[model samples]
Target: MTTGAPTPTYPARPRRSRLRTFLPLGVAAWLVLEIWLLTVVADATSGLVVFLLLLGGLVLGSVVVKRAGRRAFQALNEALQRGGTPESGGGNGLMMLGGLLIMLPGLVSDALGLILLIPPVQKTLSRYAERTVDRKLRAASAGSFGDAFQQARIHRPDGKIVPGEVVRDQPGDEPQGPVPPLTR
Candidate 1:
């Protein structure tokens, strides 16, 4: 029968997964690798060469985006005007993504972007995107709405998926009584 304030309780914190614990380490590793690459490039070539290459990538990426983005926007507009699917009427999104990647300050990203900017590579990517979207649409149309919702996966660091289910509680599921007192 003490008059002191009742001890408060809270839900236990969720356990951090192994991946979450090591995510910072992964980022640090990537930073170290990038630094090493930059150092090697500077040593083999020259600091000035590295600077020039980075500058060239940035400028070229900007120019590519400017030209392609305008055409994409115009095509998209025209498609919309004609009441057609806007999917085919624009620049390859992957190419634009590559251009954006090139704009980032890394030689690896620049090289990847340059590869993406290639016509054959862009075409291949575009075809792959179309096939993927078509497959997704086909699946969505063939399955129940819940099937689409269940596509989300939670994977462990060991590459195993955590099993779970979607639970929908009824509207009238409020607890009938909550008069039990807390006890130590």
Candidate 2:
């Protein structure tokens, strides 16, 4: 048989759908809002005041986000232990996103991102994420590609016909007499 590497038998994963496109757009919008807020806040306040406020916000946000992340992760772990798929927390990612927003020179993004980092908001977002993932998985599994095929060989010399299963003849079974022969 010709061989290098056998061609992959399984189908490739489908590309991301429209829903996947929404996530990045949403993040970008939030980033824009954050920058706007920062500009407004920085312009209204003195440098020292801005520094103090940002520092305090960072400290408070970190504590809250960290606790929330821990709790969410624990819940996910528990679900996995129970033989269930772990739910998305969304909090951890939001927290990081929030931190990034905060680092950018703007008050609006920081506020919005920090809000997202909160446990309750993150929990809701996480639930939404979980539902989305579940839907996609279900859809894929229900499709034809989900069904697998098996290959079998038939023991025919000419390869003109293939026999499948055979039903055994009983001990008392008799063969019919056949005197006629095929004529060319």
Q: Please, what is the TM-score per model?
A: 0.58, 0.44
**Per-residue lDDT of candidate 1, residues 1-184 (tens digit):** 7699777665599999999999999978876876788889999999998898779889988887787788788888888999996767244577688888788777777888889888888888888888999999987699887765666666555445665676776998876687586232
Worst 10-residue stretch by lDDT in candidate 1? 175-184
What lDDT is reached at residue 42 by model 2?
73
Q: Model 2 — which ten-residue stretch has the worst lDDT?
A: 146-155
Total backbone clashes of candidate 2, pairs 3 or more residues apart or in separate chains: 7
Q: Candidate 2 — which residues are off by over 4 angstroms?
A: 1-33, 72-105, 117-123, 145-184
lDDT of each residue in 10-91, candidate 2, tens digit only: 5587989987979999878977876666566778886677777778767766665576578678878899899998765546
